[model samples]
Target: MDEEKKGTVHYKGAEGGWGSVRGITETWMREVDRPGALRTLERQNKPGGFMCVSCAWTKPAHPHAFEFCENGAKATLWDLTSRRCTPQVLGRHRVSELKTWRDHDLEQLGRLTHPMRYDAATDSYVACSWQEAFEGIGRELRAIDPGSAVFYTSGRASLETAYLFQLFARLYGHNNLPDSSNMCHETTSVALKKLIGVPVGTSVLSDFHHCDAIFFFGQNTGTNSPRMLHPLKEAVERGVKIVTFNPIRERGLEVFRDPQSPAEMLHLKKPTLISHQYLQVRAGGDIAAITGLIKHILAAEEKLWAEEQRHVLDVDFLEQHTEGFEALKAHVAGVGWDAIEAESGLSRADLEAAAQVYVEAKNTIVMYGMGLTQQVHGFENLAMIVNLLLLKGNIGREGTGCSPVRGHSNVQGQRTVGISEKPELVPLDTLAELFGFDPPRDKGLNTVEACEKILSGEVKAFIGLGGNFVRAVPEREKMEAAWTRLRLTVQIATKLNRSHLINGQVAYLLPCLSRTEVDEQASGPQTVTMEDSLSCIHGSVAHNKPASEHLLSEPAIVAGIAKATLPPNPKVQWDEWVADYGRVRDLIEQTYPDEFAQFNERLFTPGGFYRGNAARDRVWKTESGKAEFTVPDHLSAAGFEDAPGRYRLMTLRSNDQFNTTIYGYSDRLRGIEGTRDVLLMHPDEIAAAGLKEGQVVGLKTDAGDGIHREVGGLTVTPFLLPRGCVASYYPEMNALVPLSHHDQESKTPAAKAVPVRIVT
Candidate 1:
């Protein structure tokens, strides 16, 4: 085959069966190989290795030979690559030269070797000792008006590291701690916190095994969260109904052949995953679908009341614990069925069928993801979901609860350890009392607010503990512009990314140890706690060798910077805690007594522990001390109907990706052979626009305010996506997102709803 033909990305030859083997071979032979690659793979099977560095799903510590997904394997391999990123190697290349490389190529170039600083005079980076880098960063931070510094945390950071980072920021008198979770699950946390007085989900992962029915809304489990597939597969084996609501029909929701199940090996049989019905909801129309279902349930409840039969809702609980029942009923009654049917793209009958499933089931679980959270009214959407579940008495039960599948492994733990920029005053007071230093009381900037402050020249320094902050945010131009104005920028990360390209007046890149790498401190190998999406607190110990000898653990880096930056240290014994992470957990135990009691001893148990909350029994923690129902409004983008050529563009994830991490171009389960260049559209719309499968087209927002994004020569695929809706992978169409566009309550960008049109 021609070189271009072979590298076409979308080309799938006749020998498709050997693709996995070929990819493994190619990645091993040509890409890079580690000294203890098999040892790292073996570590994944052990109890102490951190959660799959890929997704947020938590599993029991089974001693299987291998318990990782293909994408997970890829993440591990990529992290453990043989390539090295040394200061000498970086010295040879200019910043502009490195900018020319693709994001993947830059990361694949290898692991960061040592601390370095950017010298704009020479337009290149130079090696700097860790001590010098810390002092330089500390000088910049201490000199700046305390409010002018912003600190960011990545989801990949362990709970212990995040805790220390937040503590250091507090002592420095700046709370500007924004993180990856701010963009993904902030809405879920906000909505749930308002409705239930808790920020995390209610159920544990094991709860899925006991549920008779599972309702998945606004989630693409296979691509965004492959670990969820394990529970769904187990549910299928036990004959549990799994109904899904999404704009696109994901293949993982159709059928799955469990790699662990033996029955599939001999007969090559795949088990069905979708329930009796799969509803195709329009993008940004989840509220409408959920509202229609709630309406159906209300009617059913009325009929049962007239017949003197017991309904699903706990009438006594509603009367005593809740106060807005009458008002909630009035709101649901006033919502017209015609509007619901039109907006949802599902007829009343379709909703009734799904609602009946929820009503009839004795055990139920409702789960959602960013698709529901990244919207203009994402908070309201989640509030409506809570209302639906509350009607059926689903909250606070064994197998029945609401779950927001958090995007990052330890994001929940980060919050638990007080990583919030807007933390409650109580925690601040307690920390001050414990540390004997007055904590800063001023509220800090969120991710969006921090970027705005930076752009306006109010913020002079940016410190990121982990994560590719630049690539994760939207409106790339504005984000890059803000980053350039910084007086000093410091990033502690395992790999190089575009964020490093947006150089500041003085910039530093500090290499850190990956969670999968065994972190050896003065005390020996250390273990950190990560709270899974299900609210399970577990210990993770690294089993692989360090990527580099110079790299330090995130906690130690925080302590080192704190020592150099702050004066007198407040007598907290910073060096001691840095040397021993267990002391950090000891502080966590003091901070959160209800959950972290005996934190060190509890972590020794397999799968760790579940932080107990009262919500496990349907208790209302809302302002009224009861589950409150917020009315769902009918969403009809008023001018969309009249706009001549406008279409709704929904950002999607490819099968090979997991939020900000692009493993490769292929979406295996979607049958999208091997490329992310294809746009999924309804066939009728494609024909109407005079376009073919492999033609080039331009996509632009309705009224371009200098926000024009074009995906030229994109292959078109016919899918079940609704009319007036076009789907493309995210970060590609992320430019279409406006800087000011986000959920008002949660501050999460509206990546799912963008008005656009295709041009020939």
Candidate 2:
């Protein structure tokens, strides 16, 4: 709110170290139980304690004393906040008044302490009993056609909770299960499953140990998953080559000093350089950049074979373990360097140099994140990454694979246990026999389709296991409008979010427990299971006290709703599942017997058991019986880069934020402090647009649909990026991404590549 402060301050320190410590201290002090918070933090990622409630990075076999990072600490203490959003606390503010509040301020109101329902006449939420809430939700579900309802889950839920949540929806007569993955990594799932036979990332944490070279694309690892800095730093210190391709110069890939390392924390000069070479590729230019890499690689392979009777590519590996090599190589050869340079915003020389790193390294691991996945050609982008790795036989080997750095805990696990839109992924026959009811066989609506259905009056009921749904979606304004039009809306949450204020005709804010807090049922203290981003399964038990006596665990809430909505069935024991979460795991193992074999016994393993990747063992479950090299007709999403007088606007997150949750206004590493309304642009572009630094401007996106998509009041701050690219924080910039502007196959919103113009 300060007119004088531009909110962009130059940062000169290492990624972690003191900056990380300060972050932890800020959140720790906010807890009423400061010492209790410290005690809770100590329990993170330990055998008997709960897993870190933030990022889904795996716990090491030999864990560290401090297993949490800056973001993880914030997520933990956020749940342990002293402030409580009780009935008396909430009643003081009207719905109209709360709507005007900032997303940060709304969450700072603290955890929801009781079940609350909207009072339409008063325009406020009043306290209601859990029983009353469930009964009302049941009545609404029964009234509406089951086809007109959706069950949405955030990545925050445990595997046990996601399983039951999906079951409740299916038994109620639909498979309309949409989740955060539908927005983030759905492209990875759709692409990888088709190419490699497995949907999840191939690399586990151990893969970093043996990797000779690692290529990172589009992911800002430092902020998204600070804990990942440890492995990357270790890899660098030991002389592993790291190459990065991103539109913006993300601080995470530059330098870092792990706070957990005593030697580094005590010395400012001990910062570890992360990337050997950083490429500023344009947003949505992954397709071009990767294609260019392949082009260089193919040229090298031909020269080597012709001149020296040698091979630059893994000729034997490709012959034995892969298919479509000749076709893919031919496709790469056809793409000219000029087009690659123009589209990628990188020179041919840079691509050649990076290609040399790839060819020279014995074992390489390639990783990408939402930036590549959240694009118009998202599915194609992922397929290309796989194609690149396959050329080197980078998969199904030690330290050689394709890795998707996932956001939030259990997001991947949720899909693994059946939170899916695709009907075929769910074992309908098995579920039918197990639950004594017929499971829906039709394909369900994804997030994008869910929004359209809601707007079209086809969807009347909605349920969210966790997350601020309306706030995280594209064309947020339209979705928020349709959200209020729903016949019923239910949110099982730990905190009050913007979605809570946007009430439906019948809205219920069902308070639920954070994973870090104790979850007790009839059997005793329950320990739920979480599958890390890379398919490692582990159990966690809360050590901290519950936020509220009235709040229920996510599993309990799902079971409660199932009981209220479904007719009494002897086969599906909702009460038993709630009382003992392990019962849910038993059912999950029955559904996925191989992956979850000996579920209960192996769950509590010291570092958790790896569910294993079939592709890692050179077992391709694909129809081809081999890893397929998918060749696209050409590079993907080409028109955006060539469009004159326009910039590719990417929606990003601040260091202090996770997903849609904003911890504060500071992004210390990027020199951002006190504001989230700033736009990151190159200095040359700022001058070219006739816009001075620190000047407020507006960005408008013309999707050619007659709908005006614009965001104003952005303070233009100069930063490193491609000439035609610009960046802004998410949720604020969600307006720029039209709902229709998404991948045709995956339906993942192209948040990284919305074409826009700066208007003075």
Best by lDDT: 2
Could you tell me the lDDT of residue 408 within candidate 2?
A: 82
Residues 1-760 of candidate 1: C-alpha lDDT, one tens digit per residue? 1132221222222111233334444555644554566667666624666666667776565545666655566677778778888988778889889888766667876889898999998898898899999899888888988888888998878888888888889888878888888888889778888887777778776678788889888887755565567677778778788878887766566555555555653335544444456778888788888878888888888888789887766787677655667777898788888989888888999898999888788778998888788887888888877887777667776788888877777787788788888856239877987888888888898888887787688988888987888877877767787788789899998888878888789899999988788889888898887877877777887887887899988888888888889888546778889778899999988988888888888875666578876677566677877777776554542113426578778888775666666666656655575567677787677788788767767676663565565555567776557767888877667666666667878788777877777867
Candidate with maximal TM-score: 2
Candidate 1 Cα lDDT to native: 0.76
Assess candidate 2 and give its TM-score to the true structure: 0.98
Clashing pairs in 1: 396-616, 396-618
